[model samples]
Structure formats: C-alpha cells, structure tokens
Target: MVLVSYILAPTLAFCNSYGTGLTDWNLSSTYGKIGLFIIASLVGSDGGVMAGLAACGVMMSIVSTAADLMQDFKIGYLTLSSAKSMFVSQLMGTAMGCVIAPLTFWLFWTAFEVGSPDSPYKAPYAVIYREMAILGIEGFLELPKHCLALYCGFFVGALLVNLLRDVTPKKISQFIPIPMVMAVPFYIGAYFTIDMFVGTVILFIWERINRKDAEDYAGAIASGLICGDGIWTIPSAILLIFRINPPICMYFGPSASS
Candidate 1:
C-alpha cells in the first residue's frame, strides 16, 4: 500500500506539479525499488533504545515509517482514524511482525544457502531464527503458549465482566464485552486491538468527504498502514542479516562467490 502511494502520489503530484506523464504502476515499482532499503530498515527494527542502534537498518526503517506518515497525511484524502489508533496499530504490527518477519529471512538463508557455512546469507536475523528454528520454539510454533496465557487473562477479565453483568445486566457486557467464546481470544489480541477495522472508518470518511472518489484516499490510507502498521516487518528480515553486500565485496574468500 505504501509502495503504491509513494509511487503514485509523487507521480500524480509530479504531473500536476510538472508536465511528466507515466502510468501509475511504472512509477510505483520504480520508487519501491529505490526506497527498498528504507523499507527494509523500518520493517527490520522499530527503534529500540540500545539494541536498535546496532541495527542501523532497523532504526532507519522506523524513522522512515514515522517520517513518511506525517508527510503523506498532507496529501492523504482519508483521515478518519485518530492518530492514537495509528500508533497502536504500528506497535501491534511490530509485535506480530516480530513473528512473521523472521520466516522470510530464514526461508532464503536455509533454502538457497543450504550447507554453505561461509555463505553471505548468514546475517543477524538469520542466525537468531536458525537458532530458534533448531530449538523449535519460536514464531507461530509459540502460538499455543501465547494463546494459553492470553486466554488466562481473558478468562479472568471476562469472569469479572460476567459477574457484574449478572447483577446490573444493562449491557454491562457492552462496556466490557464478552469475547467470542468459541473463538477463544489470543494474547496478541489483547495487545493488538484487532484493528484492520480502522481502515473502514477512514474509508467511510473518504466516501463522505471526497464524494466517494477514493483513489487517493486509498493510497493515503495504505501509505499510513504500511508506514504505520507495517513498519517493523523488515527488521525481521534484517534480524536475519542476509549480507546484502556480497561477501566478495566485503573480501571474505573465493568460495564466498559460489
């Protein structure tokens, strides 16, 4: 989404700003390639106090997300969701990304460089995930334990909600709603707020304000989501450390090329 907007916004604004003419897809891909590094950093790391400094890529990645969001809102046609929700979404995405992000790094390192000890594929995240995957207790595999802890919290919270509703019963559940019983709430939900829902509010606002012409609004909202919610996904990649600069460039050895 950010890819599409970062591409189109400049081009459309450029056409309006200048006299250039080009198809939207062409423009988007071009910018996406150019900004891939920044995108990488933001996804890979979300700016921890000390640890993030070592991850230059990840720190840059977080800055890029926040910077782009503020700037994009100027041209953004949809601005319904409050800034607070956007912030929460960013953190939520980061936590979820902490799980999904490493998978990509691992896939590349494990599959392509299998049995190559000195391969450039070994980076920070690759090492961590390789360790974890070997341990077999990380990412989605940890979901059961995560869910159990979450359900414990929810059960406690819901018990309180239930007891109160029994007494007053005037939609006390409305205030602290009983979660989907069969569905079973997960710990991630406690933190995440399940807010792919915010986009609906933004879209509805765009419909009313922009006369239902949602093209730019779509771009704006998407840019917000990517830079906003999708910031730390790449750090998961960087955490793996894929030697973007080949070992040959860094002068390791001849087999490094192989």
Candidate 2:
C-alpha cells in the first residue's frame, strides 16, 4: 500500500495542486477515497479496513501538502519572496502540524461528542471514507440499484462541463459551474454553502459600492474571517474542556408534539 501511494502521489498531487489553483478548493479527500477503494479491494476483506485507511491517509497527506505548498508559492511569487524561504517555511509548518494536529484532534475528541449525529463535529467525511473502504472490500456488485449508473453519469457530466469550459470564451467559461465546488455541498452538507453564499453577497455589495477598495482588501478580509473562525475554536474547545457550556442553545427542528 505504501509503495502504491508513493507511485500515485506525484500525479495525484500535481492534479490536486492545479485544481486548487483554479478553484481554491482541495479535493484531496476525494482522491483519498479512490486510494481507499483501490487498497481495500487489493487487500481483500481479511484486513482491508486498516490497509485502506492507511493508504487513504498517505494519499490525502501528499495531495493536501502539495496543494498548500503551491498556494504558498503563489503568495511568495506575488510578494517577491524567495522560493527557498517559502519552501523552508512550509517544511517547518508541516513538521509542526504533524505533531500539533493529532494532539488537537485528541483534545476535541476528549472534550466533545465528536462523530455523533447530534455533535457539531459529525465528521461526515470519515463515515463516507469508511463506507467506501467497505464497499471496495465487498465489491461493486453490492452497490444499490442504479447507484453505479448515477456515478458514471455524473462522472461523464463533469468531464463534459470541463471540456466546455476550456473550449468556450472567457465570459462563458467564467459563468460555468465548477464541479469541485459543486461536489462540496454533496459531501459536507449545505451549511458551508450558505456561509459561502453570504460571503459572496457581501463581496458583491462591497464591490458595487467601492470596487477599488474591494479589490485591494478582499483577500485580507477573507483571510481575517477564516483565521478568526479557526482561532475562536480554540477558546470554544477550552471552554468545553472546562465543562462550561454556552448559556443559550439554538435548536432547529420539528417539535416532538407536532
């Protein structure tokens, strides 16, 4: 499985990096699912679960790292920074993350009801990836009726959309839907989609009011929001660890008495 991952990593990373450049969306987990299916099928049911998960981890790391490095490189290029310095910084960050990420996950896991249906961190992708591994071990014949057909149809449709986008004029291509962006809501639910939509509306209004300012400060504004969201999570997690729940809980659902 390691050998297979090494062999596939370069191509997968290159594709993922290019896609990230185009759409600012990383599909590394999608590629990881492909790895999971392949490795699980090859290992068979006996121990396919572990092998498939291991392969998925290897593939996702390679693809995600490549995409992140490329994005940083793009920033360095725009700011006239040295490639060597950017590479070194990325290496250091990745090394730190290797230690920090798992520990942070452990903190969350201990503090919260992670992966539970009612938990905020439902970890939908983990369930999807595990199901893919099982499906691989069980073989394609186990797929529900018309599921494979639906998959093939969507695959072909995505290819056709890309082809059209590439061949069309810039104005038309700009309006064309990106398959990667579309797939996000399907996998992760529409909550983030709603957030994105709200952001887009805000940006549009800003651009209409002050085009130059919007163009100049848009990246900074977006980065601040993203960083703030991430940083806020630390305090939330710490509060949870201390058993301090928020005073107000908002629940949106049908009433049981209805």
Candidate 3:
C-alpha cells in the first residue's frame, strides 16, 4: 500500500493537470465503449480479443458497484444522511477520471487468467483477447449474455428504489439517501438466493417501511467502496486521515475534493 500510494500521488496529479476526472469515463458511459469496440475491431482479431476480455472485466466491475451501492442504500435508510453530501461524495472521485478503455481492457483481461486456476468456467480474459485478435469483433460481440444480465438487474433495482422513495413518508425517507443501493441486492438476491422470492418481497416491504430515513444512503454506500468507480477510493484514502465529524481545512488537503 505504501509503495502504491507513493507512485499514485504523482500519477494522479498528472491526470488532474490533464483534466481527467474518474467519472469522466465511468464504465456505464457508452461513448468510450462504442468507439473502443469499433477501434479494437479495426485492430483486427488480436485487438478485438483484448477488447472483449476487458469488456468482461468491466462488466464485473460495474456489477460490483451496483451491488455495493444497493447495500449502502439500505444502510442509508436506517441512517438518514444528507442527500447533497452524498451526491458530493460521489462526484468527488468522478472529477478525476480519464479514459484508457483499450489499455484497461488489456490489463484486466490479462489479470483474469493470471489469478484463476483451470476450471470448466474458463472464459479467461487473455484467451478471449487472443481470440478476438484472430477471429474479429463479431465473435467478441457473441461472447455471452451473463455480464449484461448483471448490469440489467442492477439498473432495474435502481428503478425500484426510485419508485419506493417517491411514495414513502417524508420523515422515514430521510434515512435512505439513495434507495437504489438496497434495491440492487433485492434484484440480485432474486437469482442467487434460495428464498429469493420471499427475500425480495421482504426487502421491498421493508424498504418502504424505512424509506423516510434513507438520505443519500445509497450514495454513501456507493462512495464507501468505489463511490465513483475508484474515482473516490484513491482520494478518499488520501483524506481519510481526517476522521472528524466536521471538515477541517488543510491547504493541501486531498486535491480540495476536486
């Protein structure tokens, strides 16, 4: 962690100097993706493979974000945090992002294989990249539907959260800042849990009950891990040393939260 911190300090400074914000290239954004796939295909089979693998990792990373956010929403429902503060937190990391979509693909694609041992569930990113390089983007496009499912589920959950928040009592609603975070798990839990139907119904019912207390809870949960998909994690770490209830100014404090 020490070595990592030392290296990233200068690296991040350079990015900010270049106007890169983490949210600038959030994974959900389609611009980077559309162009990336197009260019990767142009690079031929080899490049296409790399793009596909990265795409897979990107999918996982995104789903994880939704899951974590949903979890936080439930917590927020109980805590009653301020909405604006939570929103600020999400944006904090988003302000320092830049897109290196192709390179990101390469790194994550390679890493997937490096960590795993052989198993029937082998969609190793490296092999995926190599295949893309050889066959073409068409093959990459047909890779699988699993990744999309996760993202779709998360989005649907987000929708549910919004709907519940609208009808909830004003006082109770204060607890859950962002209801989507809780709703995400409710959706995901549908497929993974044995008592999925029951769990989901319970979650929805309880979510309504505590809706008033959920102020920016989802955003807080979202901020806690990647908030802005790592846009905040790094900066948050930098300023985390100041663990006070209220803010204290330091001239050089964590890039002024951008």
Candidate 4:
C-alpha cells in the first residue's frame, strides 16, 4: 500500500493542488477514498481495513500538503515574500503539525466524546471514511437499496454541472453552484451552511454600506474570525483537561408532544 501510494502520490497531489488553487477546497478525503477502495480490494478481507486506512492516510497527507503549500505560495506571491523562506516555513510547519496534531487529537479524545452522535465534535468524515473502507472490502452487496443508484445519479449530475459551468457564459457560470461546495453539507451537516450564509449576508451588508472598506478589510476580518475560533479551542481543551465544565448546558429539540 505504501509503495503504491508513493508511486501515485505525486500525480494525485498535483491534481489536488490544481483543484485547490481554483476552488480553495482541498479534496484530499476524496482522493483518500480512492486509495482506500483500491488498497482494500487488493489486500482482501483479513488485513484490508488496516491497509486501506494506511493508504488513505498517506494519500490524504500528500494531497493536502501539496494543496496547502500551493495556497501558501500564492499568499507569499501576493505579499511579495521570499519563496525559499515560505518553502522552509511550510516544511517546518508540516513537521510540527505531524507531531502536534496527534497530541491535540489525543487531548480532545480523552477530554470529550469526540465521535459520538451527541458530541459537539462528531468527526463525521472519520465515520464516512471507515464506512468507505468497509464497503470496499465487503463489496456493493451490503449497500442499502437504491444507494448505488443514488451515487451514480449524483456522479452523473456533478459531471453535467461541471460541463455546463465550463461551456456556459461567464454571467451564467458565476451563478451556478459549485458541486464541491454543495456536497459539503451532505457529510458535515447544514450548520456550517448556515454559518456561511450568515457570513455572506454580513459581508454583503458591509459592502453595501462601505464598499471600499469592505474590499480592503474583508480578508483580514474573515481571517481573524477563523483564527479566533481556532484559538478558542486551546482554552477549551485546557478547561476540559481540568474537568471544568460549562455551568450552562443548552439543548434544543422538537417538543415531546410533537
């Protein structure tokens, strides 16, 4: 699996990087699924799951790193920074992340019910990826009724959407929803969709009020929001490590009578 990944990683990573540059969306998980299925099918049932997972990890890392490096390169270009410095920094960051990410995950895993249905951090892709591996090993016989058909239908639809977007006039193409962006809600849920919509609305209103300022500060504002949200997790993790729970727990659901 590792050997196969090494042979294929460069091509797959280049494709992923190009797609990321165009869309700002890394489809590493999509590439990982390809690796998962291929490795699982080859290895057969006995050790298939483990082999498949390892292949998936390798493919995902290579693809995501390439895409991220390209993104950073773009940033460096825009900011007139040194390419050599950026490359070194990217390598250092990736090396540190390899160590830090697992430890951070361990902290969260020990601190909270990470993958549980009721957990705030459900790690939905983990479930999806595991299921993909199982499907690869077990074959399509285990799939629910109409599942394969649905998958095929959507596959065709996505291709058609892209084809239309490519051939259509720019004005029409601009309004056409990206299949990749639309697919995100299927796995991650609509909460993020709502967040994006709210953010867009805010930005639109800000632009209406002050177009120049919005154009100037929009990226910085968005980055700050994203960084702030990510940084909050450090404190949250510390609080959880200390067994300090929030005083107020809120839950919302349909009425019992309903």
Compute each candidate's TM-score over C-alphas.
Answer: 0.24, 0.68, 0.30, 0.65
Candidate 1: tens digits of C-alpha lDDT, residues 152-194: 7976876776687667756554465433321222422332233
lDDT of 4 at 138: 81
Q: Candidate 2 lDDT, tens digit per residue, 1-258?
A: 789887998899998998776546678888888888888988989989888988999999999999999889867865679999999999999999999999999999999999999999999988888887888888677878998899999999999998999999998899999886777778767655765676689899999999999987776676565445543557778998999988998777768844
Pairs of colliding residues, candidate 2: none
RMSD per candidate (Å) reads 21.4, 7.5, 18.7, 7.8
The residue ranges of model 3 lying beyond 4 angstroms of the native Cα positions read: 1-46, 53-74, 93-136, 139-193, 200-258
Can you list the residue pairs that collide in candidate 4? none
- For each candidate, the alpha-carbon lDDT, in order, equals 0.44, 0.84, 0.46, 0.83
Please state the error at residue 78 of candidate 2 in Å: 7.0
Q: Tell me the tens digit of each residue's lDDT in model 3 across 89-194.
A: 5445334323455567577776665435674436575564445445446645555767657767866886777677778998877665464333334533432223
lDDT measured at residue 19 in model 2 versus the true structure, 0 to 100:
76
**Candidates, ranked, TM-score:** 2, 4, 3, 1
Q: How far does residue 38 in candidate 1 sit from its true spot (Å)? A: 18
Model 1 weakest lDDT span, ten residues long:
17-26
Which regions of candidate 4 fall more than 4 Å away from where they truly are? 7-30, 74-80, 91-135, 227-258
lDDT of 4 by residue, 1-258 (tens): 799987898898997887766545678888888889889888879988888888999999999999999889867865779999999999999999999999998999999999999999998988888878888888666778998899999999999998999999999999998787787667556654665676679899999999999987776676555435443557778998999988999888879944
Error of 3 at 162 (Å): 15
